[model samples]
Target: MNLDFPTVMLIAAVITGMIWALDAWLWAPARREVAARKTASGGVSKADLKELNKEPVLVEYARSFFPIIIIVLVLRSFLVEPFRIPSGSMIPTLMVGDFILVNKFVYGIRLPVINKKIIDMGKPQRGDVAVFRYPKDPSVDYIKRVVGLPGDRIGYFNKTIYVNGKPVPQEIIGPYFQDEHPLSQSAELRIERLGNGEHQIVVEPGASLVEGQYIVPEGHYFMMGDNRDRSNDSRFWGVVPEENLVGKAFMVWMSWQWDQGGVIWDRIGESIQ
Candidate 1:
């Protein structure tokens, strides 16, 4: 089953909080009163009175878990959240098994589970690496680079990108090799300047090219992966709506390519470009 983590967390928090609150408001007070009456009557033993005064296991567990769940939910929803990279669509910039940290509030503070934006903090830039809910499938999360802002014309022809009729410049670096894909070997490394910043992208010269132009709609953004030819992005599906945005990926906390090696120590704590 595809379980929604945020929803699960929210439900758990609510249940625990309610249980704790109920015990404090009604059950605990009733238990204390019973204990006082027993002490005054002097018929009940001290051990029995102590047992009667003790809290139920469920309430105790609820009290212990409520605060921790709330803290985690707040941190994940409004502060920062961790995500694992499952594919190489962002090759040369992000690896296949990189665990990245996304700044949740950078885009805006959204309500958990429902993901409705409650505060407007900022919008995405052209060159930003963003994580968002897939437009076609809202349950699936996708990460890609912002290529076109709202109302901008974006075109991809001959492996070059044109933004608003101006060509985005690219400088060839060298031949690129991916350890994960040993069978495919026609990729090259290049530095692409999208807006104000530059990032490395992997382009396959021999791969079949799908060229097209698009005008970004208002309240929507065009996204393309750094692995230009290999990525399944806006070119294949559609632009990401403003409401689908999750956050901007800022850093890689851990990297582990299990098929190649165990842990990639060098990639740890590296900031995402």
Candidate 2:
């Protein structure tokens, strides 16, 4: 099953919080009062009092984990959340199995499941690697680099990007090769100078270019994967609505490859562009 983690967290927090609240406000007070009356009426056995005071297992677990679940819910919903890359569409920057940390509050804090933004903290930049709810399937979270802001004219011709009629500079760095990794033999690494900093992109030379011109609408952003000619992004579908944005991905916390058989420690703590 494709588990919706944020929804699951919200549900857990609510159920456990309600259980704790009920015990605190009604059940525990009633039990305490009953014990007090029994003690005053006669010599109530200590064992009888202990038995009355003992909490049910489910209630105990709920009480113990309520705080933890709430803390996780708040942190994940407003502060930061972790995501795992499952595809190579962002290869050379975000490899498959890369565990990334996204800054949630930087973009804005939204109500978890509903995802309605209550505050507007900042806007997405042209070069930000952002995570957002997929427009086609809101339940799916997609990661891509922000290529065009609202009201910008964007064009892709001959695998080169043009912003406002000017070509966004992309220079061929060289043929990119991973030592003994034969799967990525088809593409070359190129440096694309975006806003503030430059990042590497994988491009298949002589591959069929998916060219198009688009005018970004207000309240939306254009997105594209770093792997040119191999990405299913705005070029393939459509622009990402601002409301669907989740957060900006900033770092790779971990990378694991089970098929390749182990943790890739070298990619740990790597900063994402």
Candidate 3:
């Protein structure tokens, strides 16, 4: 079964917040009043009342974390959601272990859990690194760079990108670092200049070019990973429909290389362009 994390977070936040509020407003007040009455009647000593009136540690912790968790969940579902990079599909620009933030309402405002878009905000533009639900499997989310909008011709050949019968400019950068790993040694860095902006990309020169030409259909977009040689994107699966779009990734909040040990402090607060 595919677990819906946002739903789980929303439910947990509600349940915990309610429990905390109930304890604070109703149960705690009543308990304190009872203790005070007992003390006034001389049935309970001051020391005994003090001990009895103390809230449980678990309850105190729940009360504190409830509001914080609720705020985070709401912000994540409605404003921006944090996601960690799991693969090298967007290498050179977004490396594995990079934690990025996606703007939740960029494409449109959608109700959580139901995934029903209720507001029309804006369309995906060229050079955007977007996160979206996989068309083949709605439960799965995938990330890639937007290359073709609706009704545009997109072609990939010889490890180069062509849009609307014109080639997008790609300038070779220095050799990409391997980071003490065997798999990372295969790529070379290049910078792609799109209409909106410029970003880094990785390409494997000797790798076979999986060539294809696609005419983007209505309400759909053609997407490609920055790592041209190591990505399975629109060329392999298909174009992403408008409804499948989740959000536009706009920043890198954190990055941690587990093999290298500890947090990559430099990557924090870096804007995604």
**Alpha-carbon RMSD to native, per candidate:** 1.3, 1.8, 3.3
Provide the clash count, candidate 1. Answer: 0
Error of 2 at 162 (Å): 0.3
Q: Give lDDT tens digits, candidate 2, residues 1-273.
A: 565888898889899989888888989898899888998898889999998777778789999998998899899999999999988878789988899999999888899888999999999998999999999998889999999999999999987889989998988888876652333466788899887778989888768877989999999999999987678999989999999999999999999987667789999999998
lDDT scores for all predictions?
0.93, 0.89, 0.86
Give the C-alpha lDDT of model 3.
0.86
The list of candidate 1 runs beyond 4 A from truth reads none
Model 3, position 229: C-alpha lDDT score: 80
Query: Where does candidate 3 clash, by residue pair?
Result: none
Residue-level lDDT of model 1, residues 1-273, one tens digit each, is 676988999999999999999999999999999899888988898789889989999999999999999999999999999999998899889988999999999998999998999999999999999999999999999999999999999999999999999999999998898557542577889999888989999998988978999999999999999999889999999899999999999999999987867899999999988
**Candidate order by decreasing lDDT:** 1, 2, 3
Error of 3 at 42 (Å): 9.6
- Name the lDDT value of residue 166 in candidate 2: 91
Question: Model 2 compared with the native: what TM-score?
Answer: 0.94
List clashing residue pairs in candidate 2: none
Error of 1 at 215 (Å): 0.4
Q: Which ten residues in a row have the lowest lDDT in candidate 1?
A: 178-187
